[model samples]
Target: MEDGMGFWNLRNFNLAMLAKQGWRMIQGNDSLLYKCFKGRYFPRSSFLDAKESLGCSYVWRSLLAALPILRSGYCWRVGNGSSISVLGDKWIPNHPTNKVLHPINELADEMAVSELIDSKLHVWRSGTIMSLFHKEDADAITKIPLSRRVVPDSIS
Candidate 1:
């Protein structure tokens, strides 16, 4: 029974190590896995799309095997709103649609949520919100708190 418990602990530890390494590879662009794929480690849309390729090293294959687990816990935490795309990013919460509620074609593809903020007052620009989003979307956007201090955007 003691031996069995020891084995179970070891198995859990191994799984945890693999998960950490997989997350590191996914987050670090300089990782060998990214280099192996010519700077593309995993798809941003979903890591489940990652697959074993011909002539790939054993380490790369191991990383690929752990992607599903990594993807399960992945989430976006909005910060300064500089890096997140208003139209393409999954920033809004509890909405049926992950993307922005309404997309304006005239807006640049790189338009960030920061653009909709009033820099002076540190709040959402009411005019911009009204112009870009519907009433419900504007309400949702307003509910999201913006940081007064500058910070980098991150994913977890």
Candidate 2:
């Protein structure tokens, strides 16, 4: 819908509005809308992972429809890292896609970032990082400093 002249597109605006609702569902766990949706739609998983069902309503379908737009920017801020998958979750910094550049190998897809961190010291295990991931990914992973205090994983 682009033209030589710079102007706002109503379609994009509408899409953005829909994506905002999806974002609110992610950030506002205490809201009634989120609570209702959680009970009916995504009881066991995150909003980003929610799936379509045969009997879902139009409004619910609309929110889920905007998920691709929401997921493109969604990323995990590492903490315990136990809940995040090394290859599946978006946690890496600097990469354009906000994902790890290296491809999964030998069940590495099932590995957690915690596996590359030393629990006692709360520091990244450099040797393990270098051994498991590509140089770029290893460097990016190391660049992200770990918290001294133990914290739960959260969305970023």
Candidate 3:
């Protein structure tokens, strides 16, 4: 390769296609495939949380294998932040990890993004964010603009 980069080869291409399928399944919940997977594997949880189970279908296993790839590339567009976790979910847009990377200060990992959002105003609580995260993280958090219109958090 001119740049010393390796080719995508068959394995990489297969994984990429699988990851794309997983992405589609996440984004298009109305699809029958998504509905089937949800009912069988992740009935009470999100697709990202689904784990391998005994006697699972080959397709489900393949999709599960590609989840890590999907996660590394996906970012959640914060809405009300009700469904997103402050420390766990990937909500920060430009940050490398796409998550709150600073040490937690009196904040639980499972805390909802809504906790940092002013629901009435649909804006991030800057003071609260600053109080909780380090300067760099706080700045990153503030840079993620909020939409005044109400919408559910979606993958980007």
Candidate 4:
């Protein structure tokens, strides 16, 4: 029992040290575990997309197990809205669902919220809003406060 407690304490201390340095201590470009955790949500084309790759280290497998929990807590914060997909991103607030209902017109897959804003006026383009969003959705979108200066979108 005493040996187990000592091991547990040492493990926690190591984790705390890693946390303190923002996990920068574990830096190795070739490390499978590092690759898995660093871009778990958006993996590079060369990296393995599978949750459990064959012959993966125990650490890599453990990171895969934690991916779902990490993803569940992530939420989008609309800023300039350039990065978010108009129909695909979950930027809308206070709706039954965060995504916009079926867009009236078939917008490009990469269409962004910023495209709906009038560049000169720095406000939502009424015509575009009316065309893209349902009445209720348009009304809900209008309530979101737009900053005078454009900023980059963020994930929280």
Candidate 5:
């Protein structure tokens, strides 16, 4: 692929493609919905509108909204108070903001991408870490792995 494509791009493109077919992601910032990912978990900052990005699981929340299922239905976001909620026919937090991560989330820090790379663990969740690419419009970039059946000629 080109030089850059992250999980976010993979997910956004996946969702957008699905939306075009009529399926959609869910609309709430429900912690339950987030629990679906293998290493996914709620970050402590979910309780606050924090500036720190790039690593927090909030990206997962954003990705969920970018999912084919949710994106076709409703957009997910934070609402009044400290609630993680959705805006639709009616506005509401899917659940109480007091929702905390399961104890497993604590143990998960070690499994983060940074920790894996630092530990010299060559295997990421599955693939090898090759490059980091950040782009303004992911769809405009055709080098993305998810975009092709075979790994891009450049990387392979």
Candidate 6:
């Protein structure tokens, strides 16, 4: 394997001599080594695209354009540009069942996750009980006058 200086000089020479003159050169073995160092996500497919995109002429232009975006850390995010539905913690399926019957909280180590799980279960039970008595639910209870409210220790 070439040292960093060796790779740097190679890229320097390739970019300066070939690319600057509108000629393209995609060094296959070198690029494999380069990507291995860089943690490229889609290596094989990206390699194929790079091969075609950087074919024997004018391909360096795209690299020039791509450099800034790469430097700025502007890669696509997971939920980006898609019509996927967003769901929150309240949509947890077992919430209603767990609320009706308290479960072992020791299954979770983190206080936030465990406490939130317990709270959801309690909320579910409260709503169920309220419904049985034809009474307004906790969401309705939330809108009651602040002066008459009793807040939890965590909230205060």
- The clash count of every prediction, one per candidate, is 0, 0, 0, 0, 8, 1
Each candidate: what lDDT?
Answer: 0.69, 0.85, 0.88, 0.61, 0.29, 0.29
lDDT ranking from best candidate downward: 3, 2, 1, 4, 6, 5
- Model 6 TM-score on a 0 to 1 scale: 0.16
Put down candidate 6 lDDT per residue, 4-123, tens digits, no spaces: 665556555554453322211122334543455224322453322343232333443444434432323222111111211112111112233212132233333221222221242222
Candidate 4 per-residue lDDT, tens place, 1-156, comes to: 126555556554544453433233122345654555556533542112235656766655554454444344344567777767788666777766677866666778778888987766668787878777789889878777777876777654
Question: What would the TM-scores of all predictions be?
Answer: 0.59, 0.86, 0.90, 0.59, 0.19, 0.16
lDDT of 6 at 50: 40
Stretches > 4 Å off in candidate 5:
1-13, 17-33, 36-52, 56-72, 75-156
lDDT of 1 by residue, 44-74 (tens): 4334356776776777776666666765566
lDDT of 5: 0.29
lDDT of 2 by residue, 1-156 (tens): 455687778777877899999999987799999999999999998899999999999999988878999898888888978878888889886776667887747646678878878999999999988877789888898998789999987777
The worst-scoring run of ten residues by lDDT in candidate 2 lies at: 101-110
Look at candidate 4 and tell me the lDDT of residue 130: 76
After best superposition, candidate 5 residue 120: deviation in angstroms?
60
Model 2 RMSD in Å is 2.5
TM-score winner between 3 and 6, please give it.
3
Q: After best superposition, candidate 1 residue 103: deviation in angstroms?
A: 2.9
What is the per-residue lDDT of model 5 for residues 1-156, given as tens digits with 9 covering 90 to 100? 123653356655765664432222122234444334322343443211223345656545455344334332342222111122211111112322212212222233223222212223222212222222123111111122231122211100
Candidate 3 lDDT, 31-135, residue by residue in tens: 999999999999998888789999999989988989999878888998889889888888899887898777676888789988989999888899998889999
